[model samples]
Target: MLGKTVKVVAKPRRGTRGAVSPRAARMVLAGAVLAGAVAGCGDEPIKMGAAAVVGDDRITTAKVDRAVLDCEKQFKADQVANQVRTALENQRQQQPTSGEPADCSARSAIDTMLNIEVAAAAAKAAGVSVSESQVDRMIGLMSQQAPAESIVVALGMPKQFTRDVARMNATQGLILQRLGADGNAQSPATLQAQQQALALFRQTAGKLDIKINPRFGSFDANRMTVTPITTRLSATESGVR
Candidate 1:
């Protein structure tokens, strides 16, 4: 899949006057795109040792390693090291002993990869898809509205990571539509769709049996995404040898 090329183009972002919180948006649309490579849903072989397992597919550790390397490159591309260090320091301050600053970018890389897995699984089940334009626009919008926070919290993100978030964004609306809810924002129908799709995300994530290599973190089913965890553990994907 990494061998295939996908075209990307820049477009105008939505205005920054809206009320959508980026973290809330993360809740609404995270994990997607990467998991689209899975051949089918459930009980499939993970030929490579996996960094994560989402339903039938393996999010291979090799893939994660490559992603982390790419993210590191992206950081150097934009001089994000200082910002990342600061964010990690803040997180450490809150915990006083946990969340190593060195781990920040790595954790984000791994989390982004896992979210892509969740996204692909949920989108497949709902029969919806996300496009590059959607991803670009969403990332662009967040960047326009909250550049500081974006840099501090989500530094060194690859375009594919945003692309995955784009999928998650699209999947939420599509899942809502599939469940018979209209796409109107903030209306009753939209609310219903959001609620219903959130439930579907939970269900989808539960079925994926997602396992994180302890070196990275663990999956949080309530959020249907991976969260930072320092506790070391073994790889637990279903088909890994």
Candidate 2:
């Protein structure tokens, strides 16, 4: 679901009572790129025990661990599990693996954190702002199709960060609209708008001086995802004969 480009659905007007179509909700939720395994690069060495560095902010491994734990706990709940199962069935998707240590992996948690940071930066660069009310409204609209927790879990995000995910979705939607994305997501105009938004994200992310620890993975600007480092050894190993 991540790392793949998808259409961005136009947000429903405020005060509208209609629910967002399931297809639209899925597209919007899955639009963000997911982390992949690849080596990362940075201008300087990352701090010890840090997962990744974004601009002046250092996301610690502890934080990622906590979020992963939260996700795991949420996945254990009968309510959450039932909601997720129903939503997946509606979408014709498979169920999550049971007994996994953590439903959200460290790599994914870090990647989601990175995406939130980058999305905020991109919004600022574009001079776009999404209010808490807007985020709530978007969530409300999505809730008609599926509960917010289900949507968050399905997207591999921590349930606690539901608002953050909603805000990012709203902000990106507005940015794309400003970039000339018509209401029709399948149109050529919308495709162009998505490309422009991607460029904006790349540009803003570049200025943030992001660096990922090798223990986890590296950030790939082209794919805008955190990828794992390869373990293949060199011809001479250790760079010396």
RMSD per candidate (Å) reads: 9.9, 8.0
Task: Give residue 80's error in model 1 in angstroms.
Answer: 9.4
Instruction: Give candidate 1's TM-score.
Output: 0.54
* Candidate closest to the true structure, highest lDDT: 2
Deviation (Å) of 47 in candidate 2 = 0.5
Off by over 4 Å in 1: 1-48, 79-104, 129-156, 160-162, 177-188, 221-225, 230-241
Q: For residues 54-144, write the lDDT of model 1, one tens digit per residue.
A: 6566677777677677656655544333333344455446665332233325556655555556667778888887777765665565455
Measured with C-alpha atoms, the lDDT of residue 200 in candidate 2 is 82
Q: Which prediction has the highest TM-score against the true structure?
A: 2
> Please, what are the lDDT tens digits per residue for candidate 2 over residues 1-241?
2222222232334444333444435543442432221113584566776778887888898898898888767765524333443444443333232111123677778777777788888889999989989999878765764467655765566678888877777777888888988877677887888778777876777788777766665566565456666746442342211
Candidate models: Cα lDDT each: 0.48, 0.62
Error of 2 at 10 (Å): 26
Clashing pairs in 2: 3-33, 3-34, 36-227, 37-227, 37-228, 38-227, 38-228, 40-218
Candidate 2, superposed: residue stretches over 4 Å from native: 1-21, 24-40, 78-103, 221-223, 232-241
